[model samples]
Target: MRQYWINFKGNQEGPMSLEQLAQKGLDETAYVWHSGLADWVKITTVPELNDMLNNSAKAAQESPAELPEQEPEAVTEEVPELETEEVPELPQEEAIADEVPSLDNVIESPAPNYGGQQQYAMPVAPQQGPAPQEAPKCPPTNLVWSIIATVLCCSIPGIVGIVFAFLTKKYYREGNLEKAQRMSDYGAWSVIISIMLGIISMPLSCAMNIFKVAM
Candidate 1:
């Protein structure tokens, strides 16, 4: 006799014979396994279980009908009664009136004088600072002389004088009074140098011309 195993309700049920398996009233689709089989198969596919399955079906059909279902007994539950309670009544109170204070009940007193005892603070004038010193005036820039020298005398020194003259005016406008004064002196010197060169060059040029005519 060959024993079989089946998975029933998530558990490996048994190494039971086909006769015992048929007694379990298993469905045709139930999975069964034995050592002879490579994998679990449905009972309906097994030739050995065919006769047992047919017998089980015939026996289920010929079985006597189940007794008519008995009607469930009607349940009767008893509920307990609740007791009632009585509350006592309280006495009523009388209303009270508001009271006002009389002047005769209060004592009178006089306010003290503060006439000469308090000293008044006098307002003090803010101290004035010495008047701001006036800014010194800009020295002569000699711009007119520098321009005249640049036009009529030596160009190099005359152009230098004109540049210094412009610098003097620019520095004075920019609030640099000391630098402006120095630039003014420089412009004056350049103008004087140009005038001196013009004077000396004129005499030398006249002497050369006289010599050339004599030769």
Candidate 2:
């Protein structure tokens, strides 16, 4: 007969007989005998011993002496700053003058008549006294002129040509060849004027460049 301390339920109450120990949840498979220790060791047959060991370990971990609170370290970072640039302003008079060339130089041209001699030409009938004139049958020529004018009117000239082209196209489509021709002519003139203005501005631009260098 041998005696050993064993825990059961929630209390330690073991001084029981070996047979009683066996009846109280102790089994031969639950314990290993250490003959060198000279004692009959109580064995545990409970399947939850691993869980109990884990819980004991967790309790040991949670003990204040086992784990101390650590102070968090502060982190710092370097940031880059963006550089801003200032924009230069242009003279108001120069801006206004740049727009004036396109507006002021519109010139109208006369319409030509082939007198029914050309291919795809419309025949012109002689008018009797106060005869009503028939509408012209050609596609609107103002579209072509408008396109040309728009190209030439770049900067300021383009604005004037576009306006003239629109107005002239209306009259031209209504069988007014004179008005259409006038619009087309004005668009051509605007192109020429714009080119001349651009040429004249080149010298001023060159002078400004030289002045800038000298300054």
Candidate 3:
């Protein structure tokens, strides 16, 4: 007796006679190998195995009718099958009908108007970004006034004012509005402070000279 080997699901599980192989009830999809085979092929691909499957199928069909009575077989032969058209199963049709309700019972959403004078789409509001912070108004630079104060009033304070006047422009360009404004205020206030001091120091001396000349 010839022996065959079978592989199933990545496990090799046979080196048996055909009877032993048939006992395992393997499907034709199982791979079988025997001597002279190049590689294992599906049992269905082999002609011998194909006939074996067909024979088994015929055996299965005959098993139910294998009762020891010739009379039932004679009766079956004598009886003629009626030619009847098969109507569709009612339950399946009813199931489909239930799934999809009639249009009469369906609630519909309002349809869009496609007729004359199509209305324009509503304008969308522009996306607003963060509002820009307004730059603080820079005070007077006081550059010319600082120079005059340096000559007539106080040298140090007037020079300091001139320095800040120059800084104001630089700070403003660099987006430091706060620093620019402070520099501008410092420059203007320096000139005012110098004027006040000059008046306080010379006011009395000038008045005395004027009174003496008037006499």
Candidate 3 lDDT (Cα, whole model)? Answer: 0.53
Off by over 4 Å in 1: 1-134
- Runs of candidate 2 with Cα error greater than 4 angstroms are 1-154
Cα lDDT tens digits for candidate 3, 50-93 = 44555555556676565334324433422231121112122323
Query: Residue 11 lDDT in model 1?
Result: 38
lDDT of 2 by residue, 1-215 (tens): 22223433213344343334434543222321211111112232121222233333454568655433210110010011011111101221233235323212111111223222331221121111111122233323344544554564345775666666676666644545567677777766666666677678878889999999999
Question: Which of 1 and 2 is the better model by TM-score?
Answer: 1
Residue 193 in candidate 3, Cα distance off native in Å:
0.8
In candidate 3, the residue pairs with backbone N, CA or C atoms under 3 Å apart (3 or more residues apart, or in different chains) clash, namely none
List the candidate numbers ranked by lDDT, top first: 3, 1, 2
Per-prediction RMSD in angstroms?
52.9, 47.0, 37.6
Which residue ranges in model 3 land beyond 4 Å of their true spot?
1-138, 205-215
- Relative to the true structure, candidate 1 reaches a TM of 0.38
lDDT for 189 in candidate 1 is: 98
Lowest summed lDDT window (length 10), candidate 3:
122-131
TM per prediction: 0.38, 0.31, 0.33
